[model samples]
Target: MNLLRPFSLLLAGLSLAASVSASAAERIPVVASFSILGDIVANVGGERIAVTTLVGPDEDAHVFQPAPDDIKAVSRAKLVVVNGLGFEGWMERLAQSANYRGAIVTASAGIKARERADDDHDEHGHEGHDHHHGKDDPHAWQDPQNVIVYARNVAAALARLDPAGADAYRKNGEAYVAKVQALDSWAAQQFAQIPEAKRRVITSHDAFEYFGARYKVRFLAAQGVSTDSEPSAREMAGLIRQIKAEKIKALFFENMANPKLLQQIAREAGVTAGGKLYADALSKAGGPAPDYLSLMRYNVGQLLEKIRLN
Candidate 1:
């Protein structure tokens, strides 16, 4: 109750407040282009980073238009991460507009990109209509091997941003990479169980080209790389014919894609729709595909179950 005791207590409170402020300031602020990449950053950055995802879970980044709030996120970020192979078309403009002077990391860097032609299929009479991503496909994260690259790049970028946390970032990245490796092996075994003839699938769009390439499955799609574009009538007719001719077993649509086109193709082709895939985005927290590991495992399990049922 003495005046001197109260003055000392006030000084102590101010010191505690300053310490808390410093601790909060130490955390690296990161901005990720989408949910899938944000999950990767969280794993690699761990508690050392606070991530802001421009396009969040169950959201489509392919046609994502940046809002004004995104600029504020970018302006404060110490690091900006994106899937570089032409995936986030709005990212560059957003960063430029925000005057973000931070390090931009391409999570897909160093992976051997699959060419757009690799996923291109005939659209019957629609000669000009094709699923294209310039020269390279941007869905490399579909393959776990490519995600290993993403983890490494993220770790390196975080190390640069927060040198004191380099060891922790690298350790976390290695642990996550181990999980991805295990998933890749498990996927291979699952795919091997299915005969080559039974590996063909029809999806809502060309989002699974990298998945098909890695797993040795063939994916036929009605729409192009970007879900924003509607498939032409002739294009849908051609895909329907192909599915019927090939006796395709499984037809799946992405979580963010409109199911109507895939459903139409399935109905016309006389095959039941397969399970929904988490292609462009992750599922919500506590959901089946909350992270990269769960997403891959969930997708493979769905494909295996659906394809085998046919």
Candidate 2:
């Protein structure tokens, strides 16, 4: 009787494992261009979809190169979501290479995109910087309000692909949007505590234009809209001068960008370098900014803490 009991228990465990595997295999497959967008889609899709993120956490998407595995993932996906606004310049080529003919959803479709300004010219009036993206700055996710739009777009896309899960997607998306709205309100209140004049910040790149516009903060960066370009010597010198003259003490480094240039500028300007900010990507799992909501809160806390020193 004891031997028979052990055999039955082993058979039951194997049956449960097989059932779980089949349930997971039945989920809809979706691919997101990067981690931040992936997290948003995951929240919207919930258990109905399986998401594959190409550019991972703490990785730079500005210079991301698609691998063979990425092509395979895209080819197998039912829907592909991208940030749009020319953010993922490599997406089209990757899709072509993968022979993907599925629905490609633009997460930033309905939001008002910020245009790229030619604010990098030196005193000589020469074009001192180069931009890799289109006329719009593609970092709309920086603002939680914009992410509300993103969540809706993703939910709509998922519903079209899986009509049976429409109500579920809608409910999930609305819940996520409410959280985002709350984050935005909290952020606005936090920023209001500091005087407008003390809301200036410096970073390695111009990835926070949307955040700056949303919160009424001024963000000055060493590079242009894209992080691929290097600032000219004259341009760098001008920024250092402004940092010193303005006594901007809230200098920060981006998580995905090389910190060498910003560190050099900080040393030359005699200002201490502040903590890292999650600009283009989220932190790895178990880190400070693992998901979208956590990313916004962590960044707001860091900014407020350092800007107070200004």
Compare the candidates by TM-score and give the number of the best one.
2
Residue lDDT tens for model 1, 1-310: 5879988999999999999888878878999999999999999998888999999889988778898999999999989999998888788799999999988999998999987643256533334344335777799999999999999999998898789999999999999999999999989998998887788777887788899989888777777677887877777788778777777778898998889888887888788898899999999998889987899899999888877755
- Top model by lDDT, which number? 2
Give stretches of model 1 more than 4 Å off.
1-22, 118-120, 123-132
Give lDDT for model 1. 0.85
Give the TM-score (vs. native) of candidate 2: 0.95
Q: For candidate 1, list the clashing residue pairs, or say none.
A: none
TM-scores for every candidate against the unseen true structure = 0.90, 0.95
